[model samples]
Target chain A: MKPIQVALIGLGTVGCGVYQTLHIHKQRLEIQLGAPVELTTVVIENPDKHMKIAEKTTISTDISDILYNPEIDVVFEAINGKEPAFTYLKQCIQAGKHVVTANKEMFAAHGRELKELAQKNEVQIGYDATTAGGIPIIQTISQLFRANQIQQVQAILNGTSNYILTQMRDHQLPFSTALKQAQKWGYAEADPTNDIEGYDAFYKLMILSDLIFDRQPDQKNIRHSGITGITDEAIEKAQQDGKRIKHIASIKYDETGNLTAEIEPIAVPKEHPLYAVEGVDNAIHLKADIVGDITLTGPGAGAFPTASAMVEDLCLILSKQSAPIPVS
Target chain B: MKPIQVALIGLGTVGCGVYQTLHIHKQRLEIQLGAPVELTTVVIENPDKHMKIAEKTTISTDISDILYNPEIDVVFEAINGKEPAFTYLKQCIQAGKHVVTANKEMFAAHGRELKELAQKNEVQIGYDATTAGGIPIIQTISQLFRANQIQQVQAILNGTSNYILTQMRDHQLPFSTALKQAQKWGYAEADPTNDIEGYDAFYKLMILSDLIFDRQPDQKNIRHSGITGITDEAIEKAQQDGKRIKHIASIKYDETGNLTAEIEPIAVPKEHPLYAVEGVDNAIHLKADIVGDITLTGPGAGAFPTASAMVEDLCLILSKQSAPIPVS
Candidate 1:
């Protein structure tokens, strides 16, 4: 088997993670994949600063270097947010290349359009790293639970929010104190509004709802709330009642198959599986017709874990395995 | 695509579960697979007595009915023990037919040989139902975590054993008393020796070891212990120490890459992830280099959950997706 050419579209936290992983695990990957997964080019904003790790690979600011490179079988999009990242991915698909992305914002905004484009081009589009980081929730829903009707999806999606809530509950810290601690720990961004305001989890819930309900979630109608409203009094009250407050993102299908999606801070009892999940960890609990409730918990972020998901998608694409076909 | 034909080798607990699930979820599966999954024949020991749910399918006592049939695309083995189930699975592989099984015993005994045979014959062999019931641990290890070198696997493989331990720990019941309760609740078999003596966990650990280590486990030398020896005093002592006594099956690879496999009742601290996994639920925590630690918890056993795994395997096979290529 010939080598499978690959390229990365970012040199940020996740991009560097992917490059380091691919470089360190090159031999192991070659042996497992029966071919080399070569990192051919890396597109970054500043190529000069990132030239240390770009020894044998091309460091470019031009995304066209990847788009026009027919040998690059798969393009990994690790750049955050939409814009040129989304535009570059669209061109990559149009150029007949498989794509694996860690961009939740892009998928949340234009997932259906991108999916349709990939299908039209007969190329694969994998975004397992987009949701729950390393938990593989997307693959679980698409492949493992394909036979069952997924009636409900309850998840702790935003690790930063959960971490803040956990800190407040455990140390009796106020919301602002917990938020500052989370930022110090690098779990939260400098501007943590997206996580604190429920937008981050909202994107993930939309992606999950789209997969389970087989339609784009009505984002305007989603019942969204956040941890900004959670106070020390509410936390203490829930604790007194033998419950812990968690930022939960959930979707449910009623008897008539109507979908209701929400993201809010809820007090979960000790018996609930998500009650014990703490600190920068993500968990997804799905209730399907056949399997009842199953939960998956793991590190929701970091380069290697997210890289773990990206490489798995590459393997699936290399093996010619298609993504799980969704049902309405 | 044409309808994919399938056969079942037993109509016992898991077999009946598969039948009822397939009957009920036929349309959903068809839509998901883009092809109908048809149940062609059911081979059972006592066919005459099991005619209630055998309405639309052919019932036969002959094993050759499926093995010799050219149209049967896949064979589902739900039978117990290792005799004809093993032989029939071998024949099915030899006949170039895919085989999906819930038989852990057969796999533990002859999994490497069967896997090689399947690869040689260029047919798929799926046994997700054999380990951790509906949790999809096998698929997760093989597909999702293929990029990581798994350092350790800690799991509650035997649900009956775990349930008994939970009962003893929570209610202070004696071993025999808790065993009786487990049996009454249909969580344990009439002869619970296999579960109590650590044989059930041993088999599952062996399977997991093969997947992670890419080598067959040495079952005879494995440090095997069970919950039968867990005394009420010990459980109470552990509880006082803020720990829970759980029947844990674990495999670890050290710095020198030496493999250590064991199954025993260990007192896990409250902070440990598997400590919260209680009752008949099963949980597996994998410590890998890339992903850190990831845990999955779900129904470990039952007709429906086990059937959910079998059906997932069927869909994978029907889609012509080959099994994950094992690491050398």
Candidate 2:
């Protein structure tokens, strides 16, 4: 088989991760996929910084270099946020190139639209790395739970918020101090508002809802809150009540046509699955009609973990002899 | 799209479960797959026993009925043991029919051979229900962990032994009495030797090893033990040491090619993930080079849970517009 040529849209944490991971696991992936996945082009702002790993690969500042590259069959859109990443991905799909991305914010806002566009353009778009990283919850929701009606989805999604909440509850520290500690440990960004303000978890819930429930609730209409409002006193009170406060994002399917979706801090008993999940770990518990409650927990964020998901997507796309099961 | 035709080879617990789950989730699966999954035939010991659920479907005691039927595209081999179940499955595969099985003992012994035979016959074989049922751990190891070198695999594979151990440690019941309680709750068989003697866990560990570490250590060479030797006194002494005694099945890959595989009673600390898993629940922790330690917990065995896995295989095989990534 011909080598499966690939391109990277960013040279940041996740982009470098995808490149490094493909290097580290190149042999094993080739054996598993029966074809080589090659990094042929990388689009980055600072090409000089990545010259060491970008040897033998083309480095370009313009995104069109990747979109127009005749050999580049798949593109890894690791650019953060919506502006250029979304536009670049749209152009890549429109150009009939497969895309694998880790952009949750863009996916949450335009998942349905982009999915329709990918179908219309006769290409495939995979966002397994967009949600909780390395957990493979997206494939589980799409493939494993096919025969069951997923009645409820409860998860601890945002690792930064989880780390902060754990610090506050474990050491009795104030919210600001815990936030600083998380940032110091590199678990949170300098701004950290999106994660701490519940937007990150909300976006993940929207993507999960699209897969499991086949409906995405409007962002403005959903009741959303964050862990920043969780006071030390409230944490202590919950502890006194034999409960642990966790930043939980939940979606419940109602038989009466009321699909409720919320991302907020909730007090959970010790027996709850989310209670055992702590620090920068994420857990998703699905209350399916057949399998009861199944929980999967792992590192939700990290360069290698997220890149592991991306490489899996690339292999799945290349190894597939025909088109995949349509997600939309 | 034409309806996907399926047949069942047993009306036992898991067989009836596949039938009932297919009935309950029929419409949802049809919508999910964009085609109906019709139950074409049911081969059972007592055809009259399942008449209420087998309405409009062919019911027979002869296994050839399903294999010879050209309309049946897939077969569910839920029959236990190696004698007729294994023989019938081989015949089905020889007949060029896709097979999804829940028989672990057969799989552990002849999984590679059957997989080769399936590929030779141009059919697919899925055994997600064979190992750690309801957890969806098999797919996670095969698909999600494709990019990582899996280092270690530790799991609680035998739920009956865990249940008996919990009974012995928690209720202070002796081994025999705890075994009786497990039997009373339908958690254990009347003989109960396969689970209690560690053969069940040993088989599951073999299957997991085949997926994760890419090594199938011989059953005879691997160290194997059971929970029958675990006494209440030992459990108490371990509790005094702040540890919980669990029947653990593990595979460790060393740098010097010292691939250690064992199924025995071991003591786990409180912080260990397996320490929190109790009852009939099973947990698997995979320590990979990239993702570090990831754990999945869920029901290890049940009628519906195993059936849920089998139906998932059915849907995946039929729902795919092309063949799936072959599992070796």
Candidate 3:
């Protein structure tokens, strides 16, 4: 079997994590995929910062190095934002390379266009890390839940906001104090605008909405509110009522087929599955027609968890390259 | 595209559910699979018991009805126990037919042999409904968790047993009273010995052990116990300490590659994920090296939930018969 040549387009937290994971689990992945997956190129803005990786593989500052290389079969985009990453991925797909990415913001905005392009180009695109990390909700919905009609999905998507809310409820601390604590623990970014203002959760919700409902709602119609405005008194009252104020990203379809989606805080009762989900854990409670109610809870974010989703996607794509392996 | 011909054996609870679900969701499944799936035959013990289903397809008491029909691409076995099911499935595989089964007892005893036979004959076998009902743990472990090293698994595998335990703790009922209530609710069979004696959970656990550990433990070496021994006093004592005595089937691996497995009533603390799993709801908490701790919870039994898994497997098999579909 010929090796599947791969390239990396970033060296940030998630990028480094993916590199380390693929390096550590190379042998096992080869065995599962029935082919060798070799990382041939790494594209980064600053090659000096990753000298150790540079020694093992070619580190280039130009995306064209991978985009023009016909030998590269797959490209992983781990950079944040929607600009150059989108353009680079588009070129890669046009160049007949399968692409896997963790850019949630870019995926939320331009996923439909990219999917259509990939379909036309006859290549596959994977974005499992765009939604809840390590939960496999995308594959679960696309494959396992294909036989059921998914009614609703209530999810705790953003780990930074969830961490802040948990801190406030557990310690009775103010919002600012909780934010500072989350930042210190490396859960929140330095900017923290996207996470604390609910935009992060909104993007993930859009990704899931597109997959589950088969269409995306207009951006202006989605009602979203961040946890920054949540008061300490509100948390205390919910606690007194034996409830927890959780930042929930929810989407539901009514009997008439109208879709309703929102990102806001809800006081969840003790009986609800999302109530027990604390700290940085993310949980998705999905209601469907055939399977009834199902909830998947796991790490919402982090180096290994996010990379784990990406690697799983890569393995699935590679496994399809050969004869189908029965997984019964 | 040619329609995939399917056969169902046994019109019991799960078999009937699969038939109805496939009937109702035929159009939708056809759209997803990119091919029509036709129920061409059904093998039953007594056709008189299922006249309605018999009216729709060929109903025969003879196993060779499907085993000899080369047009029958897939066979589903939903009967209980190991004798006829194992023999029929082995013959189906040998005849170059893919097989799906929900016989946990049969799977536990002869899964390895059946898997080997299927592999030798180049046929796929699906047994997702054999364990955890609609949770899709088998697919999750085989596909999504392929990138990680799974450390341990703690699960509530039997819905009848868990339902009885929940009634015992919540209503302070004795074991026998709870067992009667479970029977009345259709959660337990008339002969509740298999469920109450923990053999049902034990069988499911062995199936999971085989998949995760790549081997099965000797039945004599497994430490097994039942919920029948638990008294009202034990439930009260655990409740006083903010704990619930859950029937937990657990498997773990040490650093030296040794395996420890047992099925017993455990007093789980409030912090444990299984502590909140009540009634017929089943939950599996898996700890893996890459993705960290993950939990999947849903209805452990019932016609539709179990049928949901079987149909999902059917769709997957049918989908694979054509070009590979990218699920990302």
Which scores greater on DockQ, model 1 or model 3? 3
Candidate 2 per-residue C-alpha lDDT over B17-115 given as tens digits, one digit per residue, 9 for 90 to 100: 899988988898888777788998888887677647656788889988887888788999998887687788889999878899999998888888888
Root-mean-square deviation (CA) per prediction: 3.4, 3.2, 2.2
- Write model 2 residue lDDT over A1-328, tens digit each, in one string: 8887888888788887888888888888788777787999888877777636646788888888987777788899887887788888889888888899999999988888888897787777789889998787886776567777888999999999999998999999999999999999999999999999999999999999988777886565578999999999999999999899999999986577778898999999977888878899998988988877788888999998888788878766665644344221
Clashing pairs in 3: none
Tens-place lDDT digits, model 3, residues B129-213: 9999988888788767878888899999999989988999889999999999999989999999999899999999999999998
> A325 in model 3: Cα distance from truth in Å?
9.8
What lDDT does the true structure give each of the candidates?
0.87, 0.85, 0.88
Q: How would you encode candidate 1's per-residue C-alpha lDDT over A1-328 as one tens digit per residue?
A: 7787999999888888888889899998898788988899999887777737656788899998998888888999998888887899999999988899999998988888898998888788889999999888898777677788888889999999999988998999999999999999899999999999999998888888777887854666578998999998999999999999999999886676567788999999989999989999999998889977899999998888898888878877776543222110
The residue-by-residue lDDT of candidate 3 on A88-176, one tens digit each, is: 98999999889999999999999988989988988888898888988888878876888888989999999898899989988999999
Best by DockQ: 3
> Model 1, which residues run further than 4 Å from truth?
A321-328, B53-56, B321-328
Q: What range of 10 consecutive residues in model 2 chain B has the weakest lDDT sum?
A: B319-328
What is the TM-score of candidate 3? 0.97
True contacts kept of 1: 0.57
lDDT score, candidate 2, position A79: 78
Model 1: how far residue A325 lies from native, Å: 20
Evaluated on chain B only, what are the TM-scores of all the candidate structures, in order?
0.95, 0.94, 0.96
- Candidate whose TM-score is highest: 3
